[model samples]
Target chain A: MISQNSQTILNVQNLHANTQNTEILKGINLTVKSGEIHAIMGLNGSGKSTLAKVLAGHPDYEITQGSIQFDQQDLLALDSEERAQAGVFLAFQYPIEIPGVANSQFLRLAYNTIQSKRGNDELDPLEFDDFVREKMKLLEMNPDFLDRSVNEGFSGGEKKRNEILQMALLEPKLGVLDETDSGLDIDALKIVAKGVNHLSNEHNAMILITHYQRLLDHIVPDYVHVMESGRIIKTGGKELALELEKHGYDWLHDNLQNNAGATA
Target chain B: MNALANIDYLSSLLQTLSTQNPGDFPKDLLPENNFPWLKQLRTQAIDQAGQFKWPTTRDEEWRFTDISPLSTLTFKPAQPGNSPALADVSPFFIEEANNRLVFVDGFFTPELSNVNHKNQLVVGNLAELATSHSDVIEHHLGQHFKSQKNLFSALNTAFLKDCAVIIAPQNTVITQPVHILYIATQAETTHYPRCLVVGQTNSQATVIEDYIALQKPANSSYITNSVAEFSLAANAQIRHFRIQRENSSAFHLANCAVSLDYASRYQAVSVTLGASISRYNLDIGLRAEAAECIIDGLALISSDQLADTHTCIDHLQPNCVSHQQHKCIADEGAHAVFNGKIIVRPDAQRTDSSQSSRNLLLSNQAKIDAKPQLEIFADDVKCAHGATVGQLDNEEIFYLKSRGIPELTARNLLTYAFGAEILNRISIASLKHTLEQIVLNQTQHH
Candidate 1:
């Protein structure tokens, strides 16, 4: 048995998934420990987003060959909402706009869904309101934002902040931030990073999927993984991100091509 | 054969009033035989009514709404009654400066009607105005609203003796809306109330028609066949509203036909709250460029009642637009029907039209039939139509319930949201407030 301090919270081995017969994530392996922040950086079409979506059990992606375990439980065996109740949260890159549904109301639903799955009594409106207001204050969000429609007519900054707000409310064990830094200004980036930092604890983990090293300046991940052609070609510490920024991805591409030629 | 003979006997009795010499029938009245086309049209109407069987469940349009009660009636044509004084019907309108037309048993009560400006407002019988204003009457009386295939409209044109005529001249804006109140008094009787409104170029006006049943016991069974026609010239604007609050034993068949020229606008609103069986047909024609029309309707039905609204907007010219939205809330064993068609012709390019019909069924027994159709021949136009029938949203209800609001209050709030889309379009403040109140009361108690 692995020690509690070093036990893996999530383990994905050679994950191969496809959507409509088109392979998206090919031969990927990842491991995340509790209380750690990992950043996955790749170019467009490199399947970084696809990996995040597959981890969350999105219906559009079919897992062809993969084994995912969360807390030693089978992760791929669960459905989307069930995966959600099992303490997996994905901050959507482009959050769905559900007209006529309030933001706070949606959060309460997600929170209650998790609670009920854990065999707990659902909080009534007053209790939920009190609970949500406290979390909103911690994020510096106006309490009135909870009454507005879910992501309807919300600005980019507000949408990203609301995503963090949801993460705070649900308090999931594993969170995937999918392109959360896209379309945000510098000030918004700091606020979002601060919220995310505040939510991470000894039992919870987060994976930040992005393309720019600029977002890394704020989140400051413990490790950075470089992905190319649906495979993690390199993994290093925070200084490796600075090295990639200075040398660009061309050096890594050349190294990968030489390595593949030698192996063939 | 027996029913035809009975109606024939009633027709002869009604014809006796026509024989009271042309002098007694008012000097300005149009001679019935002079309008050859109307004569032919009337005969066609009577013949068509005789050809088709009464609407039954076998017909697709009338499937959900059973007309058995209407078919079983042997309704005699209502004659002018003498018991209720004209003052009884005249009190429905304000006593301020304006015009009022009151009809009892389908006959115009001239003494009760007060026309402040005879030239601006023409408040008299249709036959009388046809003779006085022949040039205007000859060109428009039946020109816009022909019976064609509509049997009820044809029957209304055939018995067009005692209808109301209202005409506003060019650039004239009537401060007060002209009110026409029709009261049904006798049991097992039928009344056809027709009204014609013409707004010349650059004119603005409002017309309100209220149909109420006034009887002691209020259990009288009757049928009202009503038709209204409007013609708006360029830059003319008109607001027309109809409120039907008849007794539960009454059957109502109403039609509103409108025509708009270049750059003109017209709005037609119908509110159906009462009556056992009610049907409203609205047809709007935009014949020139930049013309706009809006038809907003709502129906609140309960207690085994049936309400049906059929609307059609024909875009015949380029750059013309029209919008239609209808909502129905059914409770108890009630059923509602909505059929909206928007047609864009080949020449009507750049036309923008949209239609939506939504129904909320409050009970398991309640049902709704919603059909929103678009027939577009123009390729460059933006035309879309949709229809949805469902119950209250469970998530919305749960959300509301979590806010300390009782389950019933939450239900009412969500229901109000369902009906708010159409009510918010009403431009008049007082009317909208009154409608909101009525809707709240109806939803809360139910």
Candidate 2:
């Protein structure tokens, strides 16, 4: 629910990126305002995740043209970790396993890193442990999850929950969640959605890149953007997802062809 | 490798070693040592040393390792000098261990040792218990090693003056670990540190064999040719920890052979951290039915150093199990080699064995050669072997960097974690904590 005086958190102007001599994100233009949720729904290989990674300053992607503005700063000028410290967070689709590093250690490092970047005092282990446990309760996470290795033997749902837990810890300004709802059952989807919804407030924004509109029912989006072939083909309200759920994406493809025919 | 030059080096070393230099060499291997059998053993070892020329690169056994640096310097045997107080060697002591045998320059220093003789455990040097434990010593001491076969093993036995010996009697269970501390003091000297531990039937004991230098010199050069043999009788359980942290300029060559009898279990961990050029040969034999052996090793080397580990797990009888994991981490022009061979003999049916060698290279100049060989003669045996040589995973680095952690700290954390897998297996709390900190400090250094 965005008010009239809401500030702009993320603004992408014709962002073009390449990786391994292949252009992935071509001319992606969008604006995410504070206190709003935008769902970028697309099929596989439609560059939905690529846009998320590009916004997060992933090293593999080289921004060939255009720019991204986060909190009025040039996001492209920062490194990946610098971008993360600057409040641009990308929840990975598949979290990596770092053996011998406890989940609690990794989470606290992430939390304190961003906390100190924001000129806030860092919490000790005991204080951070208590704070993180309170956040973990939002996703119905077991306390034992902190003792194990980071995503080493976690189930698919547990790995996604850990990503959301990171989002809740860092409290990023713009959260670009790439395929967060891919590997979750209905119950896990509700729990993760509850956590994400609890984290969303009037000051931070979220761009959820998902394949299905089922996630939109739990955490309603303010706007829905349909992407095709590395570009957003259409932008509509939350009711558009309901239309797409009733009629498959082929309906939009045929409708786009008809509209182009009529306009020509 | 010039064949003629290698032969000359071998022959000269053999000549220097086989000839009796009574006045110059330490008196430990003298002709008149009171025990006629000990004299016979030393002479036999010398004759065997003559037969084995120095191993050249042409030898299939030492293909990846070139130890020609050892032949450049003339060597002198180490002598027992001034006795240091307990405070001098306390830094390397294990607080949990009750029995400690400190060997300075390969000679047993009884003044520095603390042995509890009333705990059904017998601990002494070779000369002290040579008569009382002569039956066990004569049967197992020199008989276990490949004296007639390997060059380093033969030299170690021929110069065996004083050896740290531990005997766990039948049905006796020694609770705390017995620390065998071997300290090398002088540079340009050759020292032979020997150890023989025997566990009788149904006996159990844990022993830590530590090798260190008294001084920390960047240019110190010494030769420590060590040999330790362990014989475990039926239903015996022996856990051995061998740590070699000599000076950075020292050449540490060692051979450890463990023989496990029927239903016995042997768990051994060997860590090699500091050495200019070092080679450790571990040969474990599961002699009888239901014998099991678990072997773990780590060789962390950096900066022009070379560390080589060759292990052979021989499964001699039926119903045996052997698991071996060896890891090597090399950085900044260091080279590490791991050759793990698992042999399942013909009669060793139902033998389950697996061996893995994981090597990590931190720089472009770092080199690693990991070779896992399996020779299974029994058709029904289960054997698995693999070798991996790689750098840190980029995805893991990206994962860490994405969490706002700097790239350098991420790399250091991952590097420490790689070596921590083996350090986690250590049982002694103090030793394990010390090693963990050492691994974190050394492996994570920029």
Candidate 3:
């Protein structure tokens, strides 16, 4: 899908970010085109989720030195909601539970807010309910989830599917999914992958930050990047993910160190 | 507000409270000839009200709640001024309610009241049913509240000339809910609104005790000392909805006590939303085996308002179950207090009880003091209690914001959700929708 005219949806250059007092992301570089799917694989503390949150303009993180050009505009200038309205979405690894607010109402508000920003005709409650239900079917989500509280009392797989369901509804230009496949079972993961794939067009992009190659099988990333300690050390094609799956991270680390020693 | 702070002695405050407000207490009490027992109860309560010291923050129960500002208001007793027409009061009316008893300035207004139930259900003013239901009233009136000896209850009982009373006899089930409206017409006056609900054997009913201001609430700085007593017979059930939305400048002190017999059930949802200082004490006693009760409450306050709710569910017999959940949402410099107490006696084995108090502070200056108390003596009983006071969850807000909702809308959604948890438990659909809309508006654009 990386054609000649595919737009550059995101470009991160020397991105250095900090949370509170600690520098989490130190001089990172990444670029995602409109039709490209990038999979950033790393361990637990590798700051993959931090990158996703920073892209979504989460209030906790501060960019000390970096520039994120999203769709040829500065992404860092927008607030969280403004970033969302600009078609940037982050599917949280641990989705926060909002009790007492119905999922349908929240979904409609979000959908309408984004649609209004895009100059599209926003759907009313009944229209949105029907629309969301169709999108939910893509994720194999039960219609009953629309009435319940957002993410409250939902099963792990169900919460993951809900995140994907939201992704299908928002139809963001750049979707930063942080560990969305971690808690999902095989069936849910495929359903979520199908939902995400259905939303991806040549005008949009996705950044999949996952720990397992199992998800990359269904999503099929164009680029596989290995990150260590807040920096992307190695980049390769889709086969690199399978290699990482077989040898684990130590193979890449050893090769990286040997190459560094030879080069020095 | 600081004027009452200078009076250090509660006794002197109590003295001034009683002497300056002659008309605040009933002058010509219900005649002893017709209602001698009630007259005696009122007389005893009058003496109790006289001797009792004004509650202060020094008392364990009143700690964190300072009601001394009540002395600043002129204790002029409100009168039954021009009664509000149907249009003025109809906004507070529940659409499904067929029976209603209206009280204007603590005096039962027969012209505005109506009871249309064809069954053996008794719903009307207490004074009107004095002759026929006298025996029933005599046995239950002030019977549950007599032991509490609370100064506010005593003051309310002393003014027990007239109040809303609903008596559901054996095997009777009320089809529609009964609405008891307590309206304040005149400002700067002290009024006492009382309620007595008796559910006989195997009977069932729903009663709504609502407080409202006749005109604009800001101008009505009345002092309302209200008391409501519910007594349930064997296998009976009563669903009560008590709403206290007095004026912002008013003081509302209310006492509600319930006694459940064998296999009976009592469920109440009390919402407190107004008043400069409001205190509601609710006590439920499960007197027999297999009795059950669910007590839920919510208080939404902002500005200089202070709302306090103290609830006690006593499991006195074995095989009883009680569940209580109280929530408060405080913004601005407002203060909200919730004290939920659950007691399981020695003989109350196999009793299951749980209590939780959730308070949401919407601002840094907003204060909430939530205390959950569990007293269990039976090892075989199951008891659980918890209390939490916090601001809106930032992660939750971010989650909503990530979904394209604005930050203010997200915060309002969380705040509305916190208060709506209790309001959703309200059995009445119209009232639930109303209160939910009110909370929605209160949490918006702030």
Which docking category, incorrect, acceptable, medium or high, applies to candidate 1?
incorrect
lDDT of all predictions, in order shown? Answer: 0.77, 0.87, 0.86
Off by over 4 Å in 2: A140-144, A185-187, A238-248, A258-264, B1-37, B118-120, B146-148, B170-175, B216-219, B348-351
The best candidate in terms of DockQ? 3
TM-score of each: 0.63, 0.90, 0.91
Model 2 chain A: ten consecutive residues of lowest lDDT: A50-59
Candidate number achieving the greatest lDDT relative to the actual structure: 2
> What's the candidate order when arranged by decreasing DockQ?
3, 2, 1
Question: CA lDDT of B322 in candidate 2?
Answer: 96
Q: Scoring only the second chain, what is candidate 1's TM-score?
A: 0.87
Q: What lDDT tens digits, residue by residue, belong to model 2 across residues B1-446?
A: 12323454344545565575666555553344577788788778777776665776899889999998887666667777746667878988999899999999998888889998878899988888888899998899878765224877877877778898899999999879999999888877788899999999999999999998875454578889999999999999999998989888889999889888999999988999988999999998898999999999999999999999999889889999999999999999999999998888999999989888989998899999888888888999888888889988888888887878888888888888788778767899999988888898986755
iRMS for model 3?
A: 0.9
* Model 2 agreement with the true structure over A128-244: per-residue lDDT tens digits: 999999999999999999988889899989999999999999998888888889899999999989989999999999999999989998999999999988889999999989888
Residue B99, model 2: lDDT of: 94
Tens digit per residue, CA lDDT, model 1, A151-194: 77888888888888888877888889999999999988998999
lDDT for B31 in candidate 1 is 61
